[model samples]
Target: MHRITALAAATITLAFGLGTGAATATATATDDAARVAPAAFSCSPGNFCMYSDWNGGGTRCQWPDERKANTADNCSFIQRGENVRSVWNATGHRVQYYTGTNYNSRVGSTPSGQGGNLQGSYQIRSFKPQ
Candidate 1:
C-alpha cells in the first residue's frame, strides 16, 4: 500500500511539472507573436507621410504637395523628438529626406507613390522633392 501511494504521488508531481512547463512555453510564443505582428499603414493620397513606429504604426506627420525645411515646425511627433521609422511618398515627385534641417545629412529618398520601413535610428528633420 505504501509503494502504491508513493508511485501515485510521484506521477502527480511529474504531471503537474509538465503542465506548468507547457503553459510557460505557450505564453512565451504568444508574446513573440505580438512583438513581430506588422502594424497597419494609414497614409492618405497626394501627401508625404512619416511614421513614429515601424510598418506605419504610432503617430503620423503628413504634408500635402509641399516641401518642409523644418519638419518639427508643424509635426507634433518630430517636435517631440521621435524618430521617423517609416515613410510614404504619395506625391508626384521623388521625395528626399534628411537627418538635419534644411536638407543636411541626406538619409534617403522615396520615389513617387512608393514607401516602406526605414532604419528607425534617425529623425527626418527635413524633406523636399528630389
Candidate 2:
C-alpha cells in the first residue's frame, strides 16, 4: 500500500509538471505576439511615401511619380534635414532606394505593396522604379 501511494503521488507530480510546462509555452507565445509592432502608416495607392520615424510615424513625404532625387524640401521632416527611417511602397513596381541624392548611393529596394523600417545608414535620399 505504501509503494502504491508513492507511485500515485509521483505520477500526479509528473503530470502537473508537464501541464505547467505547456502553460508556460502558451504564455510565451502570447507574449511574443503582443510584442510585435504593427505598421503605423496609411499609404495611398499609386504612390511612394517615406516616414521620418520608424514603422511609419512622424512627418511623411509622398510622390505619385518616382523621384530620382528626393529634394524633400517640401516635406516637413526632410525639410528639416531628417532622412527617411521607413518607407511604404504603394506602387505596382519595385522601388530602388538610394542613400545619396540623384540616386548615387544604392541602399535597398522595396517590392510593390510592401514597406519596412530602414537601417540607420540607409536613410533614403531618393527612390525610383527598379
Candidate 3:
C-alpha cells in the first residue's frame, strides 16, 4: 500500500512537471514572436517585369494568357524596382517565381538568389497554369 501511494505521488509530480515545461516552451515562442522578423527580400515584381520589359534588356514582351500561363503574366507587369515576383494560378495560388522570367521561370535560382536561405526556396505547385 505504501509503495502504491509513493508511485501515485510520483506520477502526479511527473505529469505536472511535463505540463509546466510545455507552458514554458509556449511562453518562449510567444516572447520571440516580434524578434522573428520577416526574411529580407532581394527579389521583387520588377525583377519579373524586367523579363516582361524585354527579357533582360531585350524588349518589353507580353506573356500569353493560356492554361500554360494563366494570369501567370495574369496580373500587370511585375512592378518597377520590385524584384520578388509572386503570381497566382487560375485558382489563385500565389507562387513566387525566380528572378529570371524565362519560359520556365522556375523559382529557387536568381542572381539575387545566388545564396538564398530557407525562406528563399519558392513553391511551384500546379495551378490553372494561368
TM-score of each: 0.68, 0.65, 0.21
**TM-score of decoy 3:** 0.21
Better of 1 and 3 by TM-score: 1
Candidate 1's displacement at residue 57, Å, is 0.7
lDDT tens readout by residue for model 1, 23-103: 654454344212221226566666888999988889988888569899999899989888999987767778999999998
Candidate 2's C-alpha runs over 4 A off are 1-39
RMSD of each: 12.3, 10.3, 13.7
lDDT tens digits by residue: candidate 3, 20-109:
984654454334212221122212221222122211322222222222232234333333332322321112122234334443555442
lDDT rank order: 1, 2, 3
Candidate 2 on 47-73: residue-level lDDT in tens? Answer: 787888888888878887866586464
Candidate with top lDDT is 1
For residue 50, give model 3's deviation from the true position in Å: 15
Which order, best to worst by TM-score?
A: 1, 2, 3
- Cα lDDT of candidate 1 equals 0.79
lDDT at residue 107 of model 1 (Cα atoms): 92
Q: List the residue pairs that clash in candidate 1.
A: none
